[model samples]
Target: MIETMGDQLPAADIESFLPLRRCSILSYGVGHMLNDITSACWFTYLLLFLTDIGLTPRDASIVMLSGQVADGFMTVFAGELIDRFGRFKLWHAGGSVLVAISFSSVFGGCLLCQILGINSAALRTIGYSIFAAIFNVGWAATQVSHMAMVNCMTLNDTSRVALASCRNAFTMVANLTLYGIALAVFSINDAKTSVDIEDQYRWIAYVSILIGCCFVGIFLFGTKEPRLKQQHCENNQRVSWAYWFSKLLYYQVALVYMLTRLVTNVSQALLAFYVINDLEMAQSSKALIPALIYICSFAVSIILQEIKWNGWRLKAFYTTGAILWIFSGVGIFLLPSKIHNFMYLLSITTGVANALMTVTGISMESMLVGKDLNGCAFVYGSLSFLDKVSCGLALYLLESYQSSPSSEGCHDITSCQSVTRYGSGLIPAACALVGAVVTYTMNLHDTTPKSLSEPLLA
Candidate 1:
């Protein structure tokens, strides 16, 4: 069992804590990259793929929303399972296989529809939705188990940050690869028309499966979880649902982090629409925008580790990120239609902001929960649940609003940019503002590294 403050281990015993393992970190980081590659493929392409195949905007939104809801519920259940069973490696490996298979099934279902000469949009949408839900269940299990294992691997704050930074670096690589494939598959022809991408999507499925198997194999074989010192304490404690809910609601840092995650998801869901439909950019720009964002974020993540904040409060980072994001959001609204380059500038701003917020949010949560593995898993699960549900509802509303007859003028692109502006710009800005305000109100002071003796709730 890993020793935590709750374990009340003597100062001399601190040296007995498991040392950070570089090989384990590398394995986990690579697994995270693979996991995200598959996830990014779904989030960045799946809805657009659905619409391209025949579903209306609202139909696509409904499919994604259903998947998000299912994923949310599964996340809660998976968190409990992780806490109860302490089988992180098993869950991680099993969930990775499930995610790869189910994710491939989504594309396979589309292929089947095309092969069968299925012309009915309603029938295709139903088929796709079922596959999407199955994919989300696997995704929920994979993500929850993967995140929970991080804290279990190491209790040292510095080591944790190193692991997180490594993971973020892989995230950058994954984004690059993901967008590269998207650009190749979805590139426009000489007539400025998009090529048929259904076949290309099938190829993506096969690649994802291969990559998932290899990376998950690395994680399963390379990493080892230390024995937790609080095993007896956990065995004696039976936490109720009500208690979990109360803790989730009362935890200010977790709430703030959840809000940030929600905004990030909402922004992501709007990105392809904003670039392709609103900005009227070329298909290549879709890949370019995200690529630039990740590049800038990757740079910022590396720099953050070396730079000192110079007395700035932890909340200051959140506030600063929110303000930067707000500026980018407003920039999106004000950018002229003909100027595509300015979009790159906005992407950079948003990327830096995201880097700051994401690193700070994860670090803050770690500090708040200390070395409590169960608390860490539960908090992450709650955040995932809230982030998915909120983003789903937001997307449903945005898509429904855009699809209404009253918004038909938006089809002209020139006549009505309001829907796009609001969806991509004003709404995200509002969310950032709200997040900033809540973070400020938390009034948490920066504390030096110290032992935490009390339970997370206590």
Candidate 2:
């Protein structure tokens, strides 16, 4: 049997807990980075691209909403398949290729129209939605498999932390790199305005496809899957859907974590809109703001991991972070337009809050799930499903409100500052407050390793 806090495993099982090879861990990190880069490239620019190309904001939002819904459902299926097959590498490789093709197709369709001198808004809208759905299918599959592999790769807590840190570091790097590329490619004449650039978008698609394929090849060829014991495989096979649902319903920490994730996604989806159209910041500022945020977040995460914490400390960290997030939102809304230094400060503060929330939230999730559970992928998938659905709805509502005729006069940066402020600031602040309240009510004392060993229904 596996060891618990007050229980010990036999000597024979000790060998099974060895740390993974460094190269294998690095391969997983690189794969995660590439996946995120592909995701960010489209998500960061798709809405802007559509609007610049003549699609209404509402229509663009609908297209993205549809894709998110499809992705949510696919995650459920992907999780089941991953658990049933015990073959993450196959899913990872296959999903990567599909993601590349679908992602590029989104841009390629528009290019084809331009090349053929066809100017149909309806066709472009439909094409973008279809390709978005296809991309999500691949994204869902790969995300489920990749995250589950983290659990399966090692039972050693320290090794898992190291792996998680590596993934987080790469995430920051990927964000910076993608945003830098977007800035360099899209900013024309330094005018701080949207431009129709089908050629630029097409080139981005080609480059993204090439980069994605190379990283996938590296991951597939570099990493070796860990072997699970027969009893563990049996346990995984025995996990029932009812039990999974029960856990999802009853798990307070997971629900709270999902809420936090939803907040993050909503803010991310609206960020480019707020920065480019509302504040009308310079191109360099657009790229530098987010880059600074990630850098600060990465640094704070490193510090957070080094500190030792018990239940009280964890709660304190979360509470403090929540308060900071709330303040950051308010500050962003109130900050003077075109003030670069103040904006940088605000970005740094937001980044610190992000680091705090993510590190503690993930730690809480791991504690709730524990090492005994064999259906890690399913659990993550369920969370992802809830997160995407909630986020999609939130985005749709916000975009609809902003794109309405009533808001037409407010489109200019000077006139629309309040709308942008609230959309980016007050709304997210409210959500963060709710998350804080939820976190406060959680029974962290009951989340011990012993409690984790109990059945979901019990």
lDDT of 1 at 315: 71
lDDT of 1 by residue, 1-458 (tens): 33554266655335423345556567777767567787777767776777666678888888888888888888888887777776776777777777777877676555445667885777777777888888888888888777766666656555555556667667666777787776766564222222245566766767766765776777777777545524523544634455645653336766677777766667776677678776777778877898888888888877665432211445787789899989998887767656767899999999888777776766665555445565556766777787778777888887776642233323333554556577777788877888888777664432223453222111
Candidates' TM-scores? Answer: 0.85, 0.84
Q: List the residue pairs that clash in candidate 2.
A: none
Misplaced by over 4 Å in model 2 are 1-7, 16-24, 111-118, 187-196, 229-231, 235-237, 248-250, 304-316, 338-340, 404-417, 444-458
Best by TM-score: 1
lDDT of 2 by residue, 164-235 (tens): 656666667677777777667767523233343556666676766676677677877887765652347764
In model 1, the runs with Cα more than 4 Å from the true position are: 1-22, 108-118, 188-195, 229-251, 305-313, 403-416, 443-458
State model 1's lDDT: 0.68
**TM-score (C-alpha, index-matched) for candidate 1:** 0.85
Residue 338 local lDDT, model 2: 50
The window of 10 residues in a row where model 1 has the poorest summed lDDT is 449-458
Question: Whole-model lDDT for model 2 versus the true structure?
Answer: 0.67
